[model samples]
Target: MPAATRHLARRFGASQIALNTKMTIETIYIARHVDIYASSAGYRMNWVTDDWQSVTGLPRDPPLAEYGLSQAQELADYFLSLPEEERPTIMLSSPYYRCLQTAVPTAQKLGLPLYVEHGLSEWYSPVAPGTGLHPRPASAAELRTYFPEIDESWQSIYYPSRKGEDVEQVHDRANGFLRALIPYIEHKFGGKHKRVLLVSHAATVIALTHELIGDRNLPLRVGCCTLTELQRKPGETELIGAWERKRLADGSHLKDGATREWGLEDIIVINDTGLPGTENAADSPVGLQVDLLPPEVLAHV
Candidate 1:
């Protein structure tokens, strides 16, 4: 280990050093944003009503519901209960209000600087007719006003298209972030054994999981405040090692487990499969949701 790494290990403790030496593992924890006050028809309006657009002045970006706030607190308590060595060393969140709101408590508890990463921003779809363009998310500087812990010094790895991103574009954005982020972490933190927590939307969580595991066929479960863990051992070359899905979208910490869960079918449609009452839907290839990136794209990581 380098001098900086040795210092970090010593600061953390001897046990952490031993653990790092034994496994040399790095971890990424991807968390989906908690539920928001949505405007869906027939859904109960707790904080906002049907005219939520005129009420909040934010049609697309809604704040977390009352229940979601409690869930965020629970998440923080869960992190506090973990051993120091197992806790996250760095935290990143999407610029969206919901994601930032979900991450704030944990960031405060961990004493980790919250960095706004556009690469991990919510998946953007094309504008619908008569619906106008989707409102752009708050910038890092703007987010700082609400989240004082936000570290504005760090630059984002990638930014999504202004118009919107298709499914493949979203997948590519996630891949690009992974490729750039690993090297940046190695350089900034000066160690292989690092734990990073990313708070983002359901689509982004699924996309990030796909990129990390290098598998698009797996059925991903994304729920409000759910955590999906990705892990990899240190490699000989400069390239980061291939990643494995250590944990699916797990929301065991929450008192009410896995609320407002979203699946592959929610984001992508495949021959009307995976729909309710579809024949043999459980075994259908709808599980093969996202298309794998090109071989060259995977090689860069």
Candidate 2:
């Protein structure tokens, strides 16, 4: 089949059918990691954060950057890549200066109003000046010590650990946003753009992915400016997933001696068509036959 035909079939529609596992998802979550920094040789600064362990359970500190305005500018530039109408979809951010600063670029990118939502903000950190989150190393191991690939960092960002909600809680939160936003996008811009870019912190991004695709340990590292493209089948009752990721150029993790690469398998959507005890038709697109990625086979290098 020709490339164009195949691509069309990958997206869900009343008549469209995904041809293979290499399906094209319709949604993309373009996440922005906070605390942008520049490495010694002009590499993008990443991993540095305003969330010191005191408030955040992270093991390491975010990189120190001259400022995050430039990073935000770049985000805006990407949005500007789209026509004015396309950028009006959805642009949400945290209340924090860094997060708001981070979102400015995307807001600029889409020319959409930045609707700040405290619900989607980073995890809560009770570690007061006198108190602290256990001094820990800023590595995957430390993060995993809490729960496999799942950690408090994600919990705090998504749920705030305030009153209720568990793994399912955050999933519902993300799902709620998606359910409402999907219609909003279609109404505002029609089909020109169904893509919704969420400019948020790292843990929040990872957690949101976990919500859509049923994998808590998904190896998705939403570093500074990492774009996760998810193409959902149109009119399909389920989320048939497809995507890929690369390190953000000039992002901070590269400067921290971090050696990483895409483990292609990590890019996949969970097949949640009729799974028991999960989000049903009411909450999600019902009867949606999603081509999913098994969590075990999904990993990143």
Candidate 3:
């Protein structure tokens, strides 16, 4: 056994004997990828008038915008500023170009290999019959050319379907990945007491959060480069322990707070339809209230 494993084994033995000591805890941090240069037509950044095909050649994979580069740096700095013990020992990122780009700086700073996990990849929304082809993210070998920090030896726990997944399917994917991932981490690191950082897309972030907390109805805020922290104590017989959300899509570390925040409602609509913000405006009471009030009354109220 490795030195860390031997040491952890001794500690576990001691804890078992005592029966009252606290078990080790693990911390998981999920971060959304920085702003993409472009996405689907309605979801593209304000300045990106060109289509994803025109800019990236790929249908849905666009590299981060210039400002996103700066945001990545800020994320790196934030991680670096954390105390040594609080820092993540392992880092994982989606195989997508944008996610890989977002994780590179932090991986370099921490001197950790970036593991490309397909399970953490962006949500695959269904492609309309004539709209276009579903995006196939670059393979690990292809991505290595751009990000040398990628750990080619590491394999993903699970891969997302190309056909696309509904909200519930994505949630199940996240849960399944977590079930396998916890054991993998324990074996690789010699214990479940590890800090892990995962960088993925907005939809994947929400899915992961929902799985971790065991709640889908709670409003989740996922924004560009936002961080969500989850922690759990070691469970005796369970592959995974009960997790608690310490932070919810927090972007306080960034100079500019969360931008382009998205929620479960937004993703569901986007997945069902190619367009974003398609919900009927009349359904909202705020809009109806404004329309019902006179101009003078609305101005003051």
RMSD of each: 12.1, 14.8, 15.9
User: Where in model 2 is the C-alpha error above 4 Å?
Assistant: 1-26, 38-65, 82-88, 125-169, 180-193, 239-301
Residue 242, model 1: lDDT of 67
TM-scores of all models?
A: 0.73, 0.47, 0.74
Task: State the lDDT of candidate 3 residue by residue for 201-266, as single tens digits.
Answer: 888898888877778766887988899998874463332336788998998987777877887787
Can you rank all candidates by lDDT, best first?
3, 1, 2
**Which residue pairs in model 1 clash with each other?**
none
Q: For candidate 1, write residues 84-195 as lDDT tens digits.
A: 9888888889887778888999998988889988778777675433333444466688778778989988766566654456777777778767775665555445565378
Q: After superposition, how far is residue 179 of candidate 1 from its true place, in Å?
A: 0.4
How many residue pairs clash in each candidate at the backbone level? 0, 27, 0
Cα distance off (Å), candidate 3, residue 248: 0.8
Positional deviation of 216 in candidate 1, in angstroms?
Answer: 1.3
lDDT of 1 at 273: 14
Best by lDDT: 3
Candidate 2 lDDT over 63-140, as tens digits, reads: 325544555565566557767544436555544445655666566545455554444555322232222222222232
